[model samples]
Target: MKMNPLKVIKNGVITENPILVQCIGLCPALATSTSAVNGMGMGIAAAAVLVGSNVVISAIRKFVPDEIRIPIFIVLIAGFVTVTQFLISGFFPELDKSLGIFIPLIVVNCVILARAEAFAFKNGALDSLFDGIGTGLGFTIALTALGAARELLGNGTIFDIKLTPAGFQPGLLAILPPGGFIALGIFMGAFRKYQERKAARQGKPEPVHAAGCAGCAMSGQCGAAAKGGGN
Candidate 1:
């Protein structure tokens, strides 16, 4: 099948979103989203790993045996994560420290693996690259949104700069792990409601179930039996 770059990108950004939709990579999503800077740093790091791993996986998909495909993908992902970790440490030590173990943890991120297995394995190099970029950006966007919300409420600041009135008292809970779960849940719920309302407004047909009683022998007289009985 020919790969469509636009479709691939769109999938990562919306349809197959790794964060708000798919709910993958929650570890870093929660841990690094305390501030915009930290969230952006982690997102970029993960994006680099995703893009590199997707390209490598796509290039080797034809030759890889299905039995060992996952192991191979893991190795490639680990290599990219290692390179990213070193580069961040050498050039952006503060960010590296802020990110901590999450950098290496990128190797195990399900979003990267899901893309590699579901998209990259079947796609050409260019298409896989596009998918990686889209998915990475989607992740970054979600993390940034979460971070902004958390930081604003938790510290009364956006990027560590106070924005609230002098008398404002920060909500300490917003920066905690519980706050991450709460924010994510609220976002997901709201998104789902929006989709439902949109579908209703568009007059979309309800989806049919293939496993309904109409197709089952227990529905009453079976199709064959009904015809034969009448005959």
Candidate 2:
């Protein structure tokens, strides 16, 4: 089947947003979103890793043993992450510092592994590239939005420029670790509500399962409730 680049991009940016919708790669999403610059840097680094890993995985899928596919994907992903980490450290020192350990931690990010296993392995190289781009863009958008919100509230700035009037005290909590969790939870709730409302407005059949909740690591908890009519 022919792949649609536009559709792939759109899926990553909104429909299957890795952070806001899929809730994958939450560690970097939370850790690096303290500032817009940091978030964007992390996003770009992750995008590079995702794209590189996807392309490599797609090209090698036929050669890899099924039993060892997971390990192979991890090695490929880790290699790309390592490359990105060094590039950032060598060139964008400030960003490297801002992103910190999160950059190296991308080696194990579920987003990369998920795409390699699910889409890249089965798709053509070009299609896998688009998928990676889409997923990366989605992740970037989510992180940027969250970062903007956090920075604006926590520091009274956007991208380090003052936004609020003079004498306004920033809300320190917004940039704190706990705030990341709170912000993400609120965004997820809002997204679910939006989906529900959109389905109702379109007269679409109510979804049998929650979006992105299926196949999740914690699905046993959510899925059990969903099956029991507790959702």
Candidate 3:
């Protein structure tokens, strides 16, 4: 396929990170990323499934009926995820136990399905393979970073090795569920800032996000509801 592999990978990791930029698959990302190993393990496992499913879906796209394509895509994804789970369990018992049910849950992750629908089906198998590789790396980078941060802050360690001074008190909350949101928020803010700086350095205009509910980060804090009620 006529594709720039590095560019595609860069887009996935920096521009369209599944967790950091797209904000998809947060539940699994947050739940299993309490430590670096868990995060890395989950990321790699999900990436493998994503890559396999994307390539297979792209290869078989021609025959899939329009109405049932979603089901077919999901089935393909589930098959890949099942294999990935088994491989993980056999090779990385600690990771399998640490990640728990989240590994199987990869079947439903929006990132994988979104890629299947948006990129794989429309692209050639070779392109889809690279796309999968790129996006998977993005998923891995985001999770690993988040997990590392949480691990370091919460336990004063990374990959189970001490990195902090003896006097440092581990920030217990950093490993909790709330820590995920807080750490993610900080990462998002930093990512945006990095994008802004990169744009400035490149002498390009700052990217502006679409305004209003379609792109709003508030989820559903809509003033429109109250305005409609009043009217």
**Across residues 8-125, which tens digit of lDDT does each residue of candidate 2 receive?**
8787787777776676788899999998888888888999999999999999889999888888888888888889988999999999887878888999787888788778889989
The CA root-mean-square deviation of candidate 1, after full C-alpha superposition on the true structure, stands at 9.8
RMSD to the hidden true structure, all candidates: 9.8, 3.7, 4.1
Candidate 2 C-alpha RMSD relative to the actual structure: 3.7
Better of 1 and 2 by TM-score: 2
Regions more than 4 Å wrong, model 1: 205-231
For all candidates in order, the CA lDDT equals 0.83, 0.84, 0.85
Instruction: For candidate 3, report its TM-score.
Output: 0.89
Q: What would you estimate as the lDDT of candidate 2?
A: 0.84
lDDT of 3 by residue, 1-231 (tens): 477878877877778777877777788898988999889888999899889998999999999997899899888999999899889899889889989999999998878887888788888998888888998999988899999999999999999999999999999999999999899889978888888899999999996642322222222434465456553
Q: Who is ahead in TM-score, 2 or 3?
A: 2
Worst lDDT run of 10 residues, candidate 3, spans 210-219
Pairs clashing within candidate 2:
12-138
- lDDT ranking, best first: 3, 2, 1
* Candidate 2 weakest lDDT stretch, 10 residues: 208-217
TM-score of 1: 0.85
